[model samples]
Target: MFKWASYFLCSFAVLASKGSWATLQDNNQTVCILKDAPNQCGSFCLSALDPMQTNLDAIERKQGVITSQLWALISRQDVQQKSLPSLDYELRRHTEMQEKHISHLLAVQSEMQALQKEMLHSILDVYKKLNAHQTLVQESLDKSITKEVFENRLEGVDKQLLTIGSTMAILMSRSVDQPHTVQNQSLQSPQASLQESLSEIGSEPPQFEQIGSRHFFIEHNLRLNWTMAAQRCRQIGGHLASFQNRLEFNAVTAKLLTGDVYYWIGMNDLGQEGQFVSVASGNPVAFFDWGYGEPDNLGGNHDCVDIAHAKMWDSKCADEERFICQSDNEV
Candidate 1:
């Protein structure tokens, strides 16, 4: 489009120059024709024709000189016109080159657009694939983490179970060795040995003995619970007896039979928690006996009290055990 506009401008300039040249030539030719015409009348013609004819003749002479100058201008114009085609050819060539360059630019632009579109789609696809890959990897990692936690917990449980089993095995083995161990323990602890000696000897009647102000006698098969046994002793003018001190508890413990057997004494359930009160008054008893945690209502059924001088003070009120009775008088 630009090339055509330039060509039109160049052609218009050339045509205007040619038209001006032609008009100048025609006017100069008419002036020259008059300038060359004979002045046949000469001076007479000049006088009779007035001063205007003389001026007219001088104008013609000037016109002839102008006509010669105009002819020279025309010749130069013609030569310029002959050169214009080459200039036009150069202009057209330049226009063609510009058109080619514009075409190349458009082609490159189209290719860039196409490449940009393809790149955008590829990037989107890659992003989607990356998101999917990350999701799968994260899921796998989560499962692995959960499995590890469960496995660790299971391992800890297995270790704890093993420890418990080992402990149970040791307990069972100790239980299996208990009778022999007890026989050996009889040789070590004086209390255990004395009971052993009593068991070795045949059962005999209690040689009535004084332990403090109270007197006592041992009996065979006087079966009763701790409560009833205390009642029996109370009927004889005293309560079911308590040990005056450790001396009495030890002395009585030495005479009893051993093995799955128990003995009842004069002690009763006082019901005072730490201090045993006398039943006669609610006052605290002057004496008491307890193994560690004794009188603890363990097994939820030990509200009653009894003396097992060899082992502990017990509360198996339902047991039909043998008895040891106490009275105020020497028996």
Candidate 2:
């Protein structure tokens, strides 16, 4: 029995050793798989992220283009707003200019109306003066016609007187030679006296006197004011005597027989103060023979000149005095 037990124990020890070696090999393979798991997971995540990043970049580019377009539209709106105020200011200035032009036209119309009124008044005044002048001219014409009729009648009377004187003288000459008896002697004396009277009546004195180619008439019966004396001279186709020099004055004075009688001359100061002029000649008097302190402008109204002998004196025009008349002789 002891020999059989020893062989069995040796076989059991060999089997147990082979089973332990197989378990050690399995444990080593499991440890290697655990170590390589982190590397595989990292590679899978990297590949998925690449496509998502590309899509985000495209969205950002579209948003930038939209923002630029909005800014351009706002800039155009701002420019239009600024131009509106400038247009309104120009319209207001034009309206004011039109108003000023209308006001100026109204003022010119008013001034023209005032000037027309003044012209109308001046025309009325001229018409009044013309009516007064016409009345004076009619009165002067009537007086001249009456004076001419009286002069014609006087000429006829002078002719009748001359014829009667000549017939009486012829009758007296025939009766003187036929007388001697008492009745005849008385008749003869009266006839002689009649003849002598007839002879004296036939020779009449001349009315006018000639001096230095000028004829002068002295009105001894009539005395008149300066104005009336000038009118009388004109009626006889002559003017008042105007002396040119000392010799002419002396010649005129010698004809006057009446002493201390003042006679009106042609000189007067009717035109201006202290400026004596001739009425007949219409010239300044060169020869002056004024008496001492004569032209003192008495009563501030002495405007006429009168002469006594060879001396001159100033007198009022209304005073009564005889005047000398002169005229050019018919050639």
Candidate 3:
């Protein structure tokens, strides 16, 4: 027999003979019969009717495994519960950003409409003032009978006419880029005056072409980087050109030759990442003509915009290329 087995048997025999701290139980797990009497309680009480030692150890191992699995389940539940709030926050934030962007666009549109109405009212006032000046000049001419008196009156009328003309020019200058606003064609159109003003100032760039209502200086020969190109346009009383719609874009791009050539445009996101605006006016761009997989913002440095074959794409701002300039077109 094993040492432990012999030791256990000796201890049990000693305790049973002493008849101390032992009692009979419901099961047959008897350590020994009562003291000297038969079928009676004993001094030592142990569960001899329990499972074998090997079976007990296996049950213990199984219980440990079950406890570990339960703890694993509890830990996973805790992690998932902790992550739920963060995921919900991100979703709500994205939705709010989208709503704000849409509202801003609507506000800009309404503001533009308000500005147009104000301009029309101002123009009407200027016209009425001009007519009154004309009537005063005619009345002075009819009232003067002598040539010397008429000459003095005519000279005075000429000075007043010059003043009125200057005021009209200033008002007309502000309407160059507002193509959607109402204008009186019978009077002087702003477009004609714009051309005349450009002629008088002698600031029109060489080789500039008129496409639709806007004029563009598509400089295919001069290769310049984005910043340099914008500076060059400023030197010529213009900026890198910006297009407002597909028709204007197509009309201007149709003039370019077919090849791998690209031209710098005014659209850029330098002020804020992912928010493209005109480099000259610093306003959000109104139109987009992106190419396939365009605006990938490759290398995170593609903040400038370029156009080729009528399609736009984002590119590094420092790269040298051809560029277009426009003086009258702010869109």
Candidate with the greatest TM-score versus the true structure: 3
Task: Kindly give the stretch of ten consecutive residues in candidate 2 with the minimal lDDT sum.
Answer: 176-185
Q: Which prediction has more favorable TM-score, 2 or 3?
A: 3
Model 1 misplacement above 4 A: 1-208, 268-275, 278-283, 329-331
How well is each residue in 148-255 modelled by candidate 2, as lDDT tens digits?
Answer: 776676777787777756654545443332222112233345545543332332233225688765678766656788977775565455667777777778888877
TM-score versus the correct structure, for each prediction: 0.32, 0.37, 0.40
For candidate 2, the lDDT comes to 0.66
Candidate 1, residues 119-231, lDDT tens digits: the string is 99999999999999999998997877887787898999999999966865554344333323223431334444443433333333234567555577665666766655554
Clashing pairs in 2: none
Clash pairs, model 3 backbone: 20-43, 34-40, 34-41
Clashes of each: 2, 0, 3
The deviation in Å at residue 246 for candidate 1 is: 1.3
Report model 2's TM-score to 2 decimal places: 0.37
RMSD of each: 41.5, 37.2, 19.3
